[model samples]
Target: MDISLVAGLLALGAAVGFAAGMLGIGGGMLLVPFMTMLFTAKHFPQEHIVHMAIATSLATIMFTSISSVRAHHARRAVLWRVVKLLAPGILIGSWVGPWIGAQLNSSTLALAFAVFVAFSGTQMLLDKKPAAARELPPAPGMFAAGGVIGVLAGLVGAGGGFVSVPFMTWCNVKIHNAVATSAALGFPIALAGTLSNIYFGMKVPDLPASSLGFIYLPALLVISLASVSTAPLGARTAHSLPVKTLKKVFALLLYSLASYMLYKAFG
Candidate 1:
């Protein structure tokens, strides 16, 4: 790989990792879009750029999620009961989402991603109430929510935190606990999405040498390694800061990014 590309990948990885750690997002919302832009700039085939971006982003998240989960686990904040309840649905939905995504036109997927991001960001902004303490939902509801989250995660290459945290919070889970549990959910989402991407890419032609299906191994390696190193810092920062202000800021940023993505998708 070229030094310039390596540097860029590292920088992007670090930034995305920190944001993921701090915001309880999977970081794909940031990484996939940016990586798509990078692939386009590099003159990659337009048909494959977004797929590559999504696959690579999911692959990178495997390590980032591990780091984030470990940090949250160390704090004893993860709700393993919820994780167990939700895993089956998440695994199934995540596996299916990328196959559905691959069948759609790339432009359509981009537009959908933009709309979803905007909606999610707006929800975060509007629902700014501090998390209320309450009992976990019945297993079925949590499982259903997990399936929905997993599908979205696989379709858009997210860590599932954007949806998971809100769902957990709305279900009366504490904010910190929700974030921690969301971090754990990232593992299944990443695993499922990565495998799906690999399977879907098998029939595609003329892919880059380093690619495994839609995933670019070099990009995955660079980003995942750097993201893992930086995630702990983000986790620590999340623990220290007042999350309300951070959520608002992140919401605004997501809005801006979403708008840009929409423009790219439709223009």
Candidate 2:
């Protein structure tokens, strides 16, 4: 790998890790567009750029999530019982998402990602709190919600925090706890999605060197290492910072990246 590319990946990983920690996100929304840009610059196979970006992003979350969640757990913020209830369905949905993604062309996949990310960003910007009377549903409801979130996360290469945090908040979960729990949820989503991407991508031809199916191994290694180191810092900041303000800033970032991805898809 070029020294400059490694440096670029390192910078991206640091930004993503901090955002993931502070926002209770998997950082995929940030990772996918930038990774797409990098892969395009490298002149990777045009048909495979989005797919590879998604795969690599998911793989990095597997590391970042672990680091972020550990910090949240130390603060006693993670809702482990909730995680247990939702995980089974999340596993199933995440496993299926990559197979569905494999059927779409690169442009279509990029379009899908852009649309979903833009929606998520809008939701964050609005910051509407759920009604006070609402509460978390029964286990079955949680499982179904997890399924939907997992599938979407898998498709878009996100950590599912965009959807999960909102859903939990709507169910009256506190913002801090919701964020922490969402961080915890990233593990299962990333684990299942990454494996599935690899499986589905195995059939594609002409992947770049050092690729594992759809995953660009070099990006995965560098990003994961750098991200893990900073995730704890982000998690700490989340407890002290003005998170709502930070989220608004993040929302703008999301909108810009999503727009860039939309241009990539159609341009």
Best by TM-score: 2
Q: Model 1 lDDT vs. the true structure? A: 0.84
TM-score of 2: 0.97
Q: Give the TM-score (vs. native) of candidate 1.
A: 0.95
lDDT of each residue in 1-267, candidate 1, tens digit only: 788788889999998888778777867888988898888877788888888888888888888988988888888988999999998889988998899889987788888788888887887788756445555668898788778988988998888887887777667777778777888888899999999999999879988888999999999998988899888888887777776776676578678778867876887
TM-score against truth, every candidate: 0.95, 0.97
Query: How many residue pairs in model 2 have overlapping backbones?
Result: 0
Q: On residues 3-25, what C-alpha lDDT tens digit does candidate 2 reach at each position?
A: 98899999999999998998878
RMSD of each: 1.7, 1.2
Q: What lDDT score is found at residue 61 in candidate 1?
A: 84
